[model samples]
Target: MFEEHGPPIEFTAAGDTPEEQTTNLKIVRPSPGFDPASELCAEAIIKDADVTVLDFSPQQVTVRFQIDGLWHAGTPMDREMGDYMLATLKQLAGVDYRERRERQTGNFASLYLKKKQKFKLVSQGIQTGERVALYLDYKRPPLDKPEDLGMRASMGKQLRAIVNDTNMGILMSTAVPGEGYTAVWRGMLEATDRLTRDFFVMEHVGKNEPEVINVYPVEYDSAKGENPMTPMKQLMLKEPDVLAFPDIASGKLLDQIVSHSVTHEMPIFTRIPGKHCLDGLLRLVALKPDVKKLTDRMTAVISMRLIRLLCEDCKIGFQPHPQMIHQLGLPQGRVAELFKPMVYQPGMVDENDVEIEPCSNCSGIGYRGRTGLFELLMFNDELRQALVSNPRLDQLSAVAKRHGHVSMQMEGVVMIAGGRTSVEELQRVLKS
Candidate 1:
C-alpha cells in the first residue's frame, strides 16, 4: 500500500454486476478541444482534494477525488480523452505512459497556491482497462500529538496514565482499513515516557517506519518463513524494559511474549485491524486462542475514526427539526441549529445579471480540514474479570458502560453539538 493511501478503489457500483453497472454509463467520444494539462488540472479541483483518480472501465472513464477519507465522483470523460489524460499524467510523473501491461508508480511536483507539492501516481492494468490513482502526500498534516488529532482531553489523560504506568500490561490500538491506524499507534508510542525504560521495536524486514528517538528496532524477515519469537530470544540478552511489536502478528509468537515477558515488568504495545477497540480485543482472542493469557495483562485498547470538518467560510446554518435530532440520537432541546455544505448550483446567478461566486477559501467544497473521532477501552480489574467469563459484544458493551467508558459515536456527538461537524457527515463516515 502507498503512504497515506486513500480509500479502496471501486471498479463497479456496489451490489451491482459489471454488466448492470455500465448499462446507463455512456461514453461520448470526440471530446471537443480537450487539452491534457487543462483537463488534468480541472479534475484535480481545489486545495481541499488531496488525491485524484482516473479509472477507465469498458463503457466509460470516471474521475474521483479523495476528500476527508471519502471518494467523491468527478466529471466523466470519453475513452479517447481518458487515454490522453492517462498518458499526460504518466509523462508528468516520469513513468512510462506507453507501458500499460505492468504496474507503475512515480511522483511529480507542481506549483499550487504558491507551494511546491509532490504527487504520487500509481497505474495498474485491470481486466477491462487501466486504473490510475494519485496521492498528494503533503496535504495530510503531521499529527504527532493526540490533542491535535481530535482526541478528547480526558481521553488523552487516560492514555498518558497507561503509557506512564510502571506495571506490565498490554497496550493495543485498533482502526479499520484506511482509518489512520499507523498514525494513531505511532502517536501512542511517541507519548510513552520511554527515557527511563529501554524500548525495543520488533518490526518486519522492509517497512516505512518512523524513527522515534531512543527506540531501537530489531527486524525479522517474514519472507524467509521467519517469526518474531526467534529474534525475541536473541534480543532478550540486552534485557529490554518495554517491547513494542509494530508488525509481529503471529499469535503463537504473541503467546510466547505474554507468557514469558509480561510478568518481568515489561509491557508490550501492539496493533490490530478492527472497527473499534472491543473488536480488536475479540480479534486478539481469536488469534491467540487463550483468553486468560490476554485478559490478565491487558491495560487498554484504543480505537479511532476520521471525520471531516465544515469550512467556516461557506458552511450554512439552519434550524434543526425535532425528528432529525431524535433520529441522530442527540439529546432533546440541546441542539438549536445544524450545519451543512453549500453545494454549487447549475445556474446560481444573482438578479443583477452577474454570476454568484462560490467561496474562495474552500473552493466551494464547504470543507477545509478533518479531525479524528477517538474511543478507548481501558481495562480494569472488574472489566478484565468480566471479559474472562463472557467475551461477547453485547456483554462487553453493557459492562463497559458501568466503567464510564465513552464510545466513538458518543464522542462524535460532542462535535455535532458544537457545530464543528454535521449529523449527515458523521453518519456518512461511520457507515462508510
Candidate 2:
C-alpha cells in the first residue's frame, strides 16, 4: 500500500481576528482655517509620535505624506481600522502615540495626545534650505530604491588618474525649487554612509562629505579689479544664482532614494528601461572639463526604443520605384531589391505605407511598443575645446559632425529606413 501524501504547506496568516488587526489612533484634528491633510503631507512637521484617528461623527479618516516630493492622501479609513499603521509607525519612528481628554462645556472631550521625549532616533542637525523632504505613500521594495543623492569630494581625487591631475574640480547642480533637489543630494550622501552637515568646510577638503554653500552674486569689483573668471577667486566665490551643493557636484544627488536598490539608482525613469541611469551618468561625464582622457576612453552611452518592422504577413514584393531610390540617393539597383513594395490594404493603403505592410505586432499600425535605437559618439580634444569655449549646442554639433561623428538624428534615420519609426515621429523629438 502507498503512503498518503500531504498537501504543500502554505504561509501562516498573521492575525486570527479582524479586531486584533485594527487600532484607534489619535490625530491632530484640523481647525476651520487649516487643511486637514496638510499636517501629514509635504512640508508638514511630523514627529515620530504622529498618529491619525476618526472623528466622533463616524466620517472616514485619511492621512497624507510627501513621497518623492509629491503630496498624496491615503485611502479613507475608519476609526480603529488600522492597527497595523499604528504599530508600523511606532516600530519605524520609535514613538508611542495615544490620546488625551479635556473638559468642554459639560462633559469630557477627547483630543490628540502629545508627550515630549528626551531623545530622537535621527539626530537633529543644523537645518538648511538645501534639504528637501521626500515622502512615500506605501513602502516600496528596498532593492528597487535609489541610493545616490549627492556628489563626493573624493571623486575629483579618485578621477585624477583619468584626467588632468591639476586644475580639475567638481561643479554642482543649482537648486531647482520643489524638485526635491536637496533631498536627492542628501540621500546620496546617506547612501555612502558619509552623511554630515555644518562641519568646518575647509577641514573636510579631502574627505567624502560634500559641502553646502550659498551661491554668491555675480560681482565685478571695479576698485578691487577682481575678475569673476580668476580661478582662485572663482573657487572662493560662487555666483549668487548658483548655490553649490557638494552632493550635486559629485553627481550623487541624482541617486535613488531606496537603499541597495539595483534598478532605481537614478532619480528618474524613462521609457527606455536601462537608459535612464546611463543617460544620467553620460550627462555627468559631459559636465566635467578636465576629463578628456576619461571621455576619450569611453564609448557611447546605450539607449533603446522599440521600432516596427515591415509586416511580412501581408507585404507584396516589387521593385522599388526610381523616385524613392533617387530620394534615398542609393545607386539604381545598387541596394539589393529584395523586398520590393508592400501595402496594408490592397487598394486603400495610405501614402504613409508606400512600401510596407501593417504589422501583426502593431496590430496593423506598422509598429509596436518601441524599437531599441542606439547612438554612440566619443569625445576628444576637439570636443573638449568646443565645450571649454562655451559654444552653443549648434556650434558643438557642427564641430562633432566635422569629426565624422554621426548625430543622434542620423541614427534614428537608420532605424527609420528599417521601418522602426516614421520620419514624422523622429521630427517631433529630434532635438538639434
Shift in Å, residue 423, candidate 1: 1.1
Q: List the global CA lDDT of all models.
A: 0.74, 0.31
Model 2 ranges off by over 4 Å: 1-333, 336-361, 416-432
Give stretches of model 1 more than 4 Å off: 1-35, 42-47, 57-60, 96-102, 223-225, 323-331, 348-358
Estimate the TM-score of every prediction: 0.83, 0.30
Q: Could you tell me the TM-score of candidate 2?
A: 0.30
Q: Give the number of the best model, judged by lDDT.
A: 1
